[model samples]
Target: MNIPSLPPPVTRDKNALVLFSGGQDSTTCLAWALTHYNHVETVGFSYGQRHAVELEGRPRILEKLRQFSEKWNRRLGADHIVDLSLISHLSETAMTTEMEIRVMENGLPNTFVPGRNLMFLTAAAMLAYRRDLNTLVGGMCETDFSGYPDCRDDAVKALQVALNIGMDTRLALLTPLMWKNKKETWQMAFDLGGQKLIELIVSETHTCYIGEHNRLHEWGYGCGKCPACLLRKRGFMEYQSEKKPI
Candidate 1:
């Protein structure tokens, strides 16, 4: 694999907690955290999403990462599942409710659960405080996304500042995929842990907004029509195209 130039390896004493959702981007972010941080923990949210199937794969993905290598097994730490069910009550978006996925008059996808990432980070920050983790990592991306304002880099950075000020602690918020599109994300997985990680991502992670897992596609098990599945599929195709012989 042709790996891109990456940031310097994190110091062994630096600890991080990843916001893992068992989706393609989050899973890749988990792997990225594992590759960089010394001690890495994970936190997932139970937001009553329509596609809650991703939650079921969280433990399995973590276990597989543990088994992938001795180093990862040693570095991986505790996992936290936060109950943010209030999000479902607050919003009737397609992500939180059973509704057709489409863009609203606001020109944003109805799948945008307002303040979801903000809340996720807030909860993750609280957990990190208790766990003494200083860095918080997420898969939020702006390069190839559904135009969700919360996923923007500025929002994440501002949140980090607010979190640190509110808690009176310096908590670094890291978004590895902030500028990277999906194809680069796939290449990142391959670079981080080789074909095994790519295989793990393709087979184990869930990204469909509809919770469809029985039917498998080249990218993974998804409805293949939803925005999430479409992005994953296109990224996988681009990634594979680059790998083919000229």
Candidate 2:
């Protein structure tokens, strides 16, 4: 089905609180925020995981994100980075444990941390409410990856309704890549001109929840056997093929 494009700039205020994980989708969402909002700030959660190495890559990702932020900050925005790491102990899932990550066999994958997006978005809305910003951008997608229930559109809309009623604020949960697959997501990031988008995504973000943070190569660190590594490898290859000369 074709969804007609809404009016130009369906947003009310340019201020937004982005749920950044320093990954491809979130990073791409950050780039999208630069083009849409007047003020955008990012919040990254350092959830305890076997692959704590991804957290180590945050500073580098922030440097790049900050650069992107500067361009739009001068025009319609500014950006900031915030840390929220206290909830790692409260969650129970394969992502925060030493247990091996299982493939998606029973609908959702094991790496789907329970209530992650809901909790994150709710937290972000609090910050958004404080700033009186009605726009909130998250990096959750239901395409070609973990089928976490929280990443679905219904969940997002439900949460949005709850958020507004709870705080009496109308916050729009904008997901530019929700309907897109990983292949299209890569291309969007490329067109956004992240300079090293392919490289940045392939080498920077930590998808492997395992403790193998030391592994590095043409496609960053991963166990190479997990669901995430496999999906990423497939996407990277597709992205490369898409860019190659015919």
Candidate 3:
């Protein structure tokens, strides 16, 4: 798949709160926010995901990120974790349950937790409002992803508008990875913080849906078969190939 050229980085003099999940994409977004914003904070949701191991990796990733540079250490701010376990009660999708990962009759994956991203963004927006952060950053992407309707660009943009109008405040919802494929996402982490960031991501970040973190893979700690793991593995392979001699 041909990934489109990334737009120029958007710098904000104020602050941004990233919707961080301690996965590859969210880790990259946190780095991007630290690089572009004056102050960067992170917010994670505890929605009783089967892969809740990612939650444990959050602080470890953040601490390691602080060591990347003095500037980032200074810019990185407090981290917030929201208790959204209600999602498990509200939905019985594969993400919140132990059901086999398969396609539903409606054509969407059983992994598609209904309104997961929507609730995430809404909660993040509310947190941003309280924290006085004007910008909201997330790793949501339409390219190289599961066919989740919520991850689509249109849905995110509409939610952004709704969020701002409902709150009566101008909040900039930024999806830096909205168009980039997983390969391009790998490149993005490299661009933001180089090899060290990539190493940290591969060693520390968690992306497995089945909560497998003890078994490590070249791309990261995953089962290397789930949709999330497969995507990450494929992207890393492509990224490595691109860096090789022609």
**What are the clashing pairs of model 2?**
38-76, 38-77, 73-77
- Report the number of the highest-lDDT candidate: 1
Off by over 4 Å in 3: 1-12, 244-246
How far in Å is the alpha carbon of 119 misplaced in model 2?
0.5
| lDDT per residue as tens, model 3, 1-246 | 232322323444678999999999999999999998889999999999999999999999999999989999999999999999999999998888887898889998899989999999999989988998888898999999899998988888788778866998788888999999999999999999998999999999998888889888889898888899999999999999997453
- Candidate 1: clashing pairs of residues: none
Instruction: List the candidate numbers ranked by TM-score, top first.
Output: 1, 3, 2
Per-residue lDDT tens digits for candidate 1, residues 77-169, read 999999999999999999988889998999999999999999999999999999988889999999999999999888887887787779988
lDDT of 2 by residue, 19-129 (tens): 777666777787788776677677776657666676567667767655555675453333344454555677666777767566556777778877878888988888777
Q: Which run of 10 residues does model 1 get worst, by summed lDDT?
A: 1-10
List residue ranges in candidate 1 displaced over 4 A: 1-12, 244-246
Report the backbone clash tally of model 1. 0
Report lDDT per candidate. 0.90, 0.70, 0.90
Better of 1 and 2 by TM-score: 1
